[model samples]
Target chain A: MNINLTLIGQSITFAVFVWFCMKFIWPHIVHALDVRRKAIADGLAAAERGKHEQELAAKRATETLHDSKVKAAEIIAQAEKRAVQIIEEAKATAKAEGDRQLAAAQAEIEQAAHRAREQLRSQVAALVLAGAEKVLRREVDAKAHADLLEAISKEI
Target chain B: MAGEAHTSAEYIKHHLQNLVYGQHPDGTWGLAHSAAEAKAMGFWAIHLDTLGMSVLLGVVFLYFFRKAAIRATSGVPGGLQNFVEWVVEFIDGSVKGSFTGRNPLVAPLALTIFIWIFLLNLMDLVPIDWIPGLMGALGLPYFKLVPTTDPNATFGMAIGVFILILYYSVKMKGVGGFFGELAFQPFGKWGMPANLLLEGVNLIAKPVSLALRLFGNLYAGEMIFILIALMFSGGAVMFLTGGVLQWAWAVFHVLIITLQAFIFMTLTIVYLDMAHQEHH
Candidate 1:
């Protein structure tokens, strides 16, 4: 076939079409793809950061759990030691109270015994003086015997 | 298509002719009813079928792409948009791979050449008679729907690329640098004439080969299709054979058309890349 005006016609059509494509189609489509690409990249980055932060939180939680456990053990040990010391102090107080009460009771009993003994000695001396006066009144002078009896009573 | 009414050679010749419009020697401008009249129309004649069909296909391609472009979104894509974006990405990748230049025009140019040429070549798969017979029934003398089979369309597009190549060459390298590339290449300055001969041929051969290669392949393929279609005029066995052969060739031609389009686009990018490259 002979080449004719169609060649020029087709060239003009092609130029116009390419101009339209460059202006409208190519930039819009490529820009959409680029935006989607950037969106995917940003989404992936945020996900990675979230994973890192979660790991940090997990590690912090474990460390805090370990610290709490140690503090709980320390508190338990202190409570046990305080309980032992309280028990020891109670035992010492009870023993001292018993000793002081025993000492006071012993002193009171000795005092009572001494008073009873003094009363008994006075009674016995009075009874012995009465008996000696009854026997010596029949045998000797009363005045000389009275002095001896008085000295014996004072000794008693 | 009453194939039996005409002789086999007449059928074949009829299918091969274009709907030409030009002035007659008698000073009237109209369609050529016969091959002799089409031939007599000479350089001023226009192949309306090739022009109309190619422009129609181009419009179809542009309409779908423009629809997709108007609503193109980064969030999600519909079926048409996905298909369009897929093709755009493929052409973009081809450009990025072969072209190292920064011209905004090159990629779109590659895309246009690829899709438009592909759309033009796709008409080869149409049953040889559908559109032409329809047009013939409508009182048109002849119609050839596939544009890539015409050298006019191919050379027209190739010349467009050639113009761009020349432009970027002068723009990237100076006009003198562009001439220097043609004058003193593959040999020293002492061999400038020989170098100009060799390099000039090389330079001009880019568009010529690009045009002829596509035109030749599609023309030959269209010719084979026409030849196979002739068997449909024979009796039942030949008709069945023709159908099977037509199917097989069409299936194979799918690869050919796609490959030709890809080659055209790739080579355009490469030639443009060469234009953009500065000499070390």
Candidate 2:
């Protein structure tokens, strides 16, 4: 083939194409790729962060559960202590009430025993007077004997 | 195009000749009908076939790419956009690997050279006689479809790269530095003539080899196809053999065309890279 002016025409066409491509085509596509790369990177980073936050929230929930458990144990311990104290106080009140009732009963029984002994002593004195009269075979002065009998009853 | 009356040599010559439009010996402007008349038109004539096919392919290349560029997104890509991006990425990767310079033009120029040359070379697989047969029916004198077969088009592109190489070498390293490189490289100033002779040839050979390698490969490939086509005009046995041989050569030619385009683009990037390197 002979070299001719076609070389220049082809050269002109070649230059125009390269110019058009450089001006219009390359930057947009490259920019799109760059942007897509950045988006993927950002998405991965966000996912990592979200995973970390989820772990933190789970930890916080467990910690709150532990705190509530400890608090519940303390409240139960206090309730058990208050119940024991109330039981002890009731025992003390019952013992005091029993002691007061026993004292009142004992005082009444003593008074009753004293009254019965006085009655028995008075009866015994009367029987001695009657036996002495039988031994003397005569009725003594009754009014003078009464005072002595009363004194003997008091001694008994 | 050759009629059915042409002999084998005439068919081969007809297929090899370009449809040139230029001045005749009478100083009149018209299309050349004969190869001798085309030669007489000399350096002023242009090959209309090469020019038209190249520009058409270039336009097709640009239109599709321009559409892709206009709709390119960081989002999900459509099929056309995906294909366009894939090709652009291939070019970009080659450039990034081969070129360390920060010039924006290198990548796009590489893209243009690769795709445009590949498209031109792809014309070789068009069955050798389709377009010319069509043009023959319409009464055109000559039609060489594959532009890479034309030395003018290959040199056109190669010389364009050569111009850029020369421009950048001078721009990056001042005129004095560039001249000094040619005059002092591979040997000291003591061997200035030898060094200049060596480096100058090295410099000029970049474009020459680039142009010739592509032109030679496709030219030879086209010549083989033309020869096989001549076989079709023989007996039925020759016609079947020609068909099989044509298919085989065309299948193998696909690799050659793609490789030549890749080589051309690679060499261009390398030469431009060399140009942008300062002499340390």
Candidate 3:
């Protein structure tokens, strides 16, 4: 173990190895570690963002569901009001038509009764004139007794 | 069987010696004839085994880690990617805890130091005689496989760290501030000379302790293994006792090697952190 040229050779070798390591090996390893750390951080941040977005979407879906339910209820209430109005209108129309038909029928019945009474009066007058002519055995002077005949007809 | 013709001391001495190449005292540039010859060659000599084994282990470390780096992903990791990420993260945690500076190089430097030293120390666990026996058969007379067991390799790493510490100190505080730090004190400027001596020793102690601590532990561990191997060569009775002892030592040595590597890496980070501090 004398101090010799081997010392110089080993020093040179040590210098070379240290230089190679500083230049090549060390940087790559350190960079890889840093890159991995960054990637993990980014992944964690993305996961947090995704969770927040999911929560927002769920909340929106619940709000939309509630809105649709309210709208459907409003639509159903309006439809019920329209149905009641239509039923009332139909009832009013039917009542008006029945009143008009009843009035017409009553007028027609009164006119028919009046026409039958007139016919009966005229037949009774002719029958009375024929009986008077037969009882008197001659033709009475009808032109001189016009007033009396009118009165007899009125009584009859 | 290799020690069959030699005494225990010779076996241990052979295992401790490195396959060195340098100028001989006879005015020839070649492999050293002996340990004494290798020492005599002085500063010019190279321990081929330490250099070769360390470089090979370093290359292996780089190749696998480079592959893992290429396949690294921001997503979940698997297999080699997982292992690489775990090691990087472990080193990064230690650096983050110990280091206060923002320099990009500290974490990677700590990682390289930890794993590279770990791989170097792991060579000790291999049966002491396996590779040396192989090299012996191939006509190489000596081989010391574990680089950390050699003072040169550990000191080499420590010196490199020391240079970086000095560079950072100068870069952060300028040359005057750097020297001021080395000269100023646990006492005031009135005690400048004492402060200089004390702080100077403190400054020098960082690298010295870093280097020696690792080298001492691993060298001692390697010596013990050599002793155990010597025991194995004694006889059948010694072989059984040696086998049990080697296994127990190796099991315990695992913690030592890992702890030494951790201590080395942590100290480096702490020293660099201290360099970055404006006042400490």
Residue B43 lDDT in model 3? 95
- Worst 10-residue stretch by lDDT in candidate 3 chain A? A132-141
The lDDT for every candidate, in the order shown, is 0.91, 0.92, 0.90
Alpha-carbon runs more than 4 Å astray in model 1? A101-156
Report the number of the highest-DockQ candidate: 3
In angstroms, how far off is B36's CA in candidate 3? 1.7
Tell me each candidate's RMSD, in Å, in order.
3.7, 4.9, 3.7
lDDT of 2 by residue, B153-258 (tens): 9999998999999999999998999999999878898999999999989999999999999999999999999888888878899999999999999999999999
Write candidate 1's Cα lDDT for B1-280 as tens digits.
5466788789878887888999998999999999899989888989998889888988898888989998999988889889988998999898899988788998888889899999898999999889888998899989998999989999999999999999999999999999998887779799999999999899899999999999999999999998998888788999999999999999999999999999999999999999999875
Q: Point to the candidate with the largest lDDT.
A: 2
TM-score for all models, in order of appearance: 0.87, 0.84, 0.86
Clashing pairs in 1: none
Specify the CAPRI tier of model 2. medium
DockQ of each: 0.58, 0.66, 0.68
**Candidate 1 lDDT for residue B105:** 91
Better of 1 and 2 by lDDT: 2
User: Which stretch of 10 consecutive residues in model 2 chain B shows the poorest summed lDDT?
Assistant: B1-10
Q: What is the lDDT of candidate 1?
A: 0.91
Model 2 residue B119 lDDT score: 97
